[model samples]
Target chain A: MNRLVLQAQILELTAIRYTPAGLPALDLVLKHESQVDEAGAHRKVALEIKAVAIGDVVRRVQALGLAGCSVFTGFLSAQKQGRGTVFHITGLES
Target chain B: MNRLVLQAQILELTAIRYTPAGLPALDLVLKHESQVDEAGAHRKVALEIKAVAIGDVVRRVQALGLAGCSVFTGFLSAQKQGRGTVFHITGLES
Candidate 1:
């Protein structure tokens, strides 16, 4: 039961690369901003997250080209060789 | 559409504190471990995320303590004075 549904804009994107298994992978940074209700008060929330898209979703994300906001469905995992987390994208909705 | 539902165990918990606004707040670290299907391959995923419970949910999380795994529903926000993100817990399911 690890799932994340986020609506954000692609703030930065890198060239598509291939994994060791030859799967296409795209890395990007996403910027999210919204107002949320917390402790009975409305709060403005904003953050940027690092995300990656692999396999079939890579092509779709490439086509989008950081044009507008999109809803992304994914799971979070630790960076393979780093100190932070990465959102592994599995689905996308423009 | 910013939501995250994760099942994880509480790795570390801080004593309940009060916010400047007088709302109760509890901070904790969550460790998540699972197997996920990605790019047509099964991958083992594990991550430790910092999370916080405020308002009414703080009491519930305090009662649960670090006993076992639980599902948490929340939103991600940037750390107020840091570079990373924090999970703001809103709901819990044991």
Candidate 2:
């Protein structure tokens, strides 16, 4: 079971592109900030992560635009040919 | 509203250390592999992520050792001095 639920703002977006299989895809960066309790102490946490939305989720994300924050449900995967991770978005709650 | 739940194997581990505030900390890498449904297709997902366990969680992780997999509950954070992300582990289920 691998899942990540994040409430984040769309920080940056790229133009829609088509995969080799002809599926619609969008790439974006997500900024997340929240106060969390860890080790019995409250701490401020923030981050910006690269994410990708494919197929149906891409249209919803485009409609939502980048004006507000949304909750994204997804899983993490290593880049196809890189040393970092990317969030593969499957669902969105705006 | 940021949370990540992943079942992963401990791929690498560093020696336990202490923060300036004297809190115990441990750094490690986790490898996750699963088959997920995405955009109407069954996809294989795998990733190796850098993670940290602090305070009470550190001891528990050490006790669990690296022989088996565990479910980790955590949040993602930007690296303190880098361009990548790190998983800040808050809880572990063996």
Candidate 3:
């Protein structure tokens, strides 16, 4: 099980691209800021993550503006062979 | 809301440290491998994330051997100085 639920602002959006299989892909950067409970204390948290959306979700989010705040549900995977992690957006709720 | 639920192996563990406020802290690396459904397709996902645990959770995880799999619940935050993200572990379920 690998799931991430984040409400973040759309910081930047890259132009849509296509995979070798011709699937539409979109990449964006997300900025998240929130207060979270941890170990019986509330902490202020902030993060910036690079995210990618594929196929229909790509078009859906592209049609919608990449502005303001939205909740993204996805799984995290490596960006390439064995390095950094990238959030793969599968669902978006504005 | 910033929540991440991941079932991953404890790949590496660092010595327990203390925060500025004297809170017990532990840092670890987690490797996750799983199949997730996205865009109507099943995709294999794998990620290696750096995580930190504080207070009692640090002691609890420190007491247990970090040799097997465990489910972690946490929120993502910048590692330091607004740079890369780090998982802040708050709970563990083995």
Q: Please give the CA lDDT of all the candidate structures.
A: 0.90, 0.90, 0.86
Give model 1's TM-score versus the native structure: 0.96
Task: Compute the lDDT of residue B6 as modeled in candidate 3.
Answer: 94
lDDT of 2 by residue, A1-94 (tens): 8999999999998899998878999999999999988888899999999999999899988877875579999999999887789999999865
Q: What is the Å distance of residue A44 in model 1 from its true position?
A: 0.7
Candidate 3 residue lDDT tens string, B1-94: 8999999888888888998878899989999999998777788988888989998899777765576578898889987854667989898876
TM-score of each: 0.96, 0.95, 0.92
TM-score of chain A of each: 0.93, 0.94, 0.91
Per-residue lDDT of candidate 2, residues B1-94 (tens digit)? 8899999999988889998768899999999999998889998998999999989899888877775579999999899998789999999866
Residue pairs with colliding backbones in model 1 are none
Which 10-residue span in candidate 3 chain B carries the lowest summed lDDT? B59-68
Rank the models by TM-score, top first: 1, 2, 3
Candidate with the greatest DockQ versus the true structure:
2
- The better-scoring model by TM-score among 1 and 2 is 1
In the range A69-90, model 1's lDDT, one tens digit per residue, is 7999999998888657898999
**DockQ values of all predictions:** 0.82, 0.86, 0.80
The 10-residue segment with the lowest total lDDT in model 2 chain A? A60-69
